[model samples]
Target: MASYGGVAVSGGMPRFSDTLINGGVILEPWAGIRAYASYAEGYTVPDVGRIARAVGTAGVDIDDYVNIEPIVSNNREIGVELKRGPLDASAAYFWSTSKNGSLLVQTAIGAPFEIQRQRVEIEGLELNLSVKTPLPGLTLSTGYAHLIGRTDGSANGIDVVDRDLDGANISPDRLNIAASYVQGSLSARIQTQFFLSRQFERTPNAYPALYRFDGYDTTDISLRYQTGFGALSLSAQNIFDSFYIDYYSQTVRPNDNAHYFAGRGRNFTLSWDYRF
Candidate 1:
């Protein structure tokens, strides 16, 4: 080897030093309106317990099953909110970076991969709005999220500086919408979640099959009655029983029938809660 720890001739534990800053501020530009900005630094320890459970061989040190590396990330975000009259809305965008971000990748032998840390970057946007309708006892609410990630392409044996981060860190875009109605101690509502689709075609620069994704949506309806004793709620999920594969099962382990889990079918549930 040329050197140890980037030195001409030496051997010692790696050393690193840096300053961390975390803070945020909010300003109300006008009545019922506010703007905010923030920054934070954080790190998460690896889960040794879970890693140990996955070991099939004896005489293995679970704590040492994989590199006990912590991922340190820095995040910066800015957003604005408006709350006036019967309307409330907010939007925010964030960018994050981590020199030691962990991502999962399948092994060449078609087995689960060990946690590996690499350089990673991510960008995301969020939006939410809710309003009270004039039609008495009716309200509409919606929220949307968009996220994407990038990592050193060398992890995939490519010489490029950065490439798509894959499903381990990036989830397909999605939107959630719901409507509620209330009248005389009775409330009824419905909500739906829409999953965006993604496509990646294998080519000179990238491999697509491993990350291609399909879109799907599910809807649910619920009704509740308020009484002196408590509140009774009757709800149904995936009311239409839409048949589709889950996002992670399809994108993370594509083409693997064993892992192709289907979304839950239509089901009904009754719940009651009492006030103390």
Candidate 2:
């Protein structure tokens, strides 16, 4: 390790210190109905691995490659919530803007990756609902999210190729449904999640083609029992052994032609928790 005046090299382990503020207001104008609005600022630093593996110009020292700016974003949202008897629901719309956004862009299908410095805009809608059945200790819940993201077509005030931001590790649409039951000390729950099709990678300098990921879903179930001494639980994930790919595995690399990594198959787990 190298150092400068008691500071270790590698930019002192790439430290990032940021301050964020978020606030919201909820108004219950009448019984069982409420509305809210929120504003928040988000900040994120680049991954150290992204820096280490970044494709750099020849003759540049590794230490010099670690210097990169962080991404900062501001989010604004407004929503309404309802809680009437056995029904609970909420819906919201949000928009976000980011400057100096970090995106992975490859020159070709199997080429190395480089960061794209640009502005980004993301807008989305979210809806959630949950209802408790008249039946003893049973409830059903469902949720959906739709996202539309895009990037500014300018770099340094010059027009460049603009593209959708739906991919790049983010799916444009998502859905989830779950049902749960509770009686005495026993509880059971089951859930399924769906991911809508999304762009996989931004491939430029090649044929103008659409690169996307197919939609997929997975189901999981769990049961738990509480005892005097401990708790016992059992779980089955991807119950049907659905074949899929990891969300972030579409990056272009030389050895692989941007083939995605497979998702986990069916698996079962059991465990006990002891309380002291």
Q: Give lDDT tens digits, candidate 2, residues 241-271.
A: 9998665553223225346578899999999
The TM-score leader among the candidates is 1
Q: What 10-residue stretch in candidate 1 is worst by lDDT?
A: 1-10
At residue 121, what lDDT does model 1 achieve?
85
Prediction-by-prediction clash tally: 0, 0
Q: Which 10 consecutive residues of model 2 have the lowest summed lDDT? A: 1-10
The true-versus-predicted C-alpha distance at residue 60 of model 1, in Å, is 12
Q: For each candidate, what is the lDDT?
A: 0.77, 0.73
Cα lDDT tens digits for candidate 1, 1-276: 111112122223433356778999999979999999999997776554333334445465433333445667999999999999999999999999887677665554356555556677889999999999999999999999998777774757643336777665578899999999999999999999999987642234776766678789999999999999999999999999999988878777776777778889999999999989
Q: List the residue pairs that clash in candidate 2.
A: none
